[model samples]
Target: MAVYEKVKRAIEQMVGDKSSEFKVCVEDTRGTLGGILIKIEDVKTQEISAFRINEGDEGEAEHMTMYSVDTMLQRRKAEGIARLEEIERVLGIKFEKWQREYILSRGLGYPIGGRRTGRTLAHQVKTLMKSKDDIIIYPNQRWTYLDEPERMRNSERYAQGYVKKLRELSEKLRNHGINVPRVIEVDDPQAEFLTKRMNLPARRGDGMR
Candidate 1:
């Protein structure tokens, strides 16, 4: 019989379709017992079963795992564009493309792409901002400035104001048991970089006391 057929039957017989969802794979080996290997999946628990397809050996082996699609999707959805924007709003950081992707990738969600989605997400973040971190005193990329130097100067001023406000806010948040970043250093001369790392939880609704 075919390798897939053998594995399919094994999965139906052992785990059953009602109890599990799985995919099958056939692999060829080079050094160790080189032959067609039939593999079966238990998607509900992210478990795997492997069996060799040789005339002499037909033994099955179970691999340890906790593989569940629900779990994986939950993790990924948390990293959605909406979530990153929420973090940006909460920490009062200007949203950067790399940072959004980083957060989305962390939770296994789709990355933000293009202006339509980006703008929609940005708007959504404004709604989600709970405190001062939601406000950007100086916007990045020069929304309106005469020259690069003028923009940089204005940005520097904005950074200084943002950091000073952030420090004051951080003190208040700390008092209420909200975790804030250490703010090791900023170089706006005026403090303009204003890049701070906030302690957002891995999942939503986690901020509620």
Candidate 2:
């Protein structure tokens, strides 16, 4: 059997009836080198998960090296197990049972936000509102506070304005029953605002004003 076929069989056995609509296909990576991509969809909820198996080419004869059928099968099995664990962790339940109960009960609904992508102003405010105990605020914008000497020389006013904004925001949240203990000011490396504000003329060599 071909390498792709072997991989497909392994994934099928691992998922069982849970992946009735699964798909396994080969993707071209470059000239004479390619990999297999597998996509598994939850039968009840139709939620999809994907995994890949790259063509192994690491050795003295890198181009000549290829993954054996057994190696590909092992990789597919491991990836399938990982996908199940990820689903369980995100949804807070066993994958098999969750599929049978919650997914079937609610037609099609999947849990989101298992990882922290980035901090936004709205997200920070919401977190503060939900906190029961006093929470310290770390303003997401780094360039707002002049904690260092370089920052003080660059744009102290801009930093002050950022702190002022945080204070105002904290006050508003306090009115809504959110306890903000303190707001820690931190300096940002990429001072875009400071650069734009201080568009000073090039200084010539001398003690001239």
Candidate 3:
């Protein structure tokens, strides 16, 4: 018999007369090494239990045992309750209801990429605030002046302005109970290079030549 069929029969036997209350589903994880997720849902109570059975050597009968399946279900139920409690404490709303409202209220934006850039700084700060850490400030690549002396001088001025804005933002977040790190300007190679570039005289005019 197929592994899925055997598991399904085992689950049915475990649920007994209350089998109608549960629904079983299998999802394939598409990749070179195939894996599958088995989910059992309590339709009446809207509770879900799941387990992953990866492609490998295993005694399937052992995992499909009534004791093993029941234990897994109980553990999943406990975890779900805990997660719901955490969500309630943080947002003062049940996760299921909040999820429904959130989905309806806003359009899901594009997926975030792994690489951090200046454009994603605001999002990064928001994520940091969600954590328990005192503060975190991740600075990405330094601004490139592209050999323009005047632009290099302007970049320094811009950096100062950026620091001021960061401080203000941090203060605002602190007022809202979000602790953020102090924004400090450090003397780095980029700053030193810009300073030297700013002092260099402009090249001779080609118009005169």
Candidate 4:
């Protein structure tokens, strides 16, 4: 509760004068592991966004998130080309590049690798799927998500963001010739999402229904 208060106040400060119009909730996403999930909502418009601060992360990457995919693509393309050229010069092999844009909600997109790159990814995934004899579950990739979804999903609007990401990601995977959707739903009786108790009675007693 103390930690929640501290983080709530910090967010309130960041939100400024309109902070009163917004509601913020903080929960330990993974109990005893210290991963924090923050959800914010507008009272009038009911606009919402979610962010997570991982156990060891200082929230630096959230700030470092690139809004301009063009800039990021340019930088990454240059680095990739340099690496490719070096490999080609030394190994006597040629390479190809493919560029395509898949809209992420609107106005934001990630410039991913070429058709060959995607095909390679599909091959690797197929290899993994068939590896029942040598499968290692929970490989410890340490990939904790941040607020990138809120930024990229539904053009900065959030309610349908998760769904949009799921559907689009499925489409992208199919385009990569992968037969699996990168989304899943677990029906947990203990689970709730984007829900809150409005008032005391609404939370408990007569209004519980």
Best by TM-score: 3
Query: Which of the numbered candidates is closest to the native, going by highest lDDT?
Result: 3
Q: Arrange candidates by lDDT, highest first: which order?
A: 3, 1, 2, 4
By TM-score, highest first, what's the ranking? Answer: 3, 1, 4, 2
Q: Rate the local accuracy (lDDT) of all candidates.
A: 0.42, 0.39, 0.45, 0.37
Q: CA lDDT of 2 in candidate 1?
A: 53
Off by over 4 Å in 3: 32-34, 56-58, 61-209
TM-score of 2: 0.22
Model 3, 1-209: lDDT tens per residue?
36566666776777665566567676676473367666767664466766666654225432744555586567645654554354344444443443323322212221433434222333223322323333322222122211222344457565445445555655655565544444333446465455458994322211111
Per residue, candidate 1 scores C-alpha lDDT tens digits across 90-175 of 55676666545443332223355444444333332322232223333333422121112243455756545534544455454456
- Where is model 1 more than 4 Å wrong at Cα? 1-70, 73-154, 186-209
Looking at model 3, the pairs that clash are: none
Model 3 residue 62 distance off true place after TM-score fit, in angstroms = 6.0
Pairs of residues at least 3 apart in sequence or in different chains that clash in candidate 2 = none
The candidate 2 region of ten consecutive residues with least summed lDDT is 200-209
Kindly indicate the candidate among 3 and 4 with the higher lDDT: 3
Q: Give the per-residue lDDT of model 2 (tens digit) for 1-209.
A: 25445555555555454334344445554454345444444332344454454553223111111223234444544654554454334435554443323222212222332333222232333233233333322334323222232434456466567456655666654554434434444345444355447983222111111
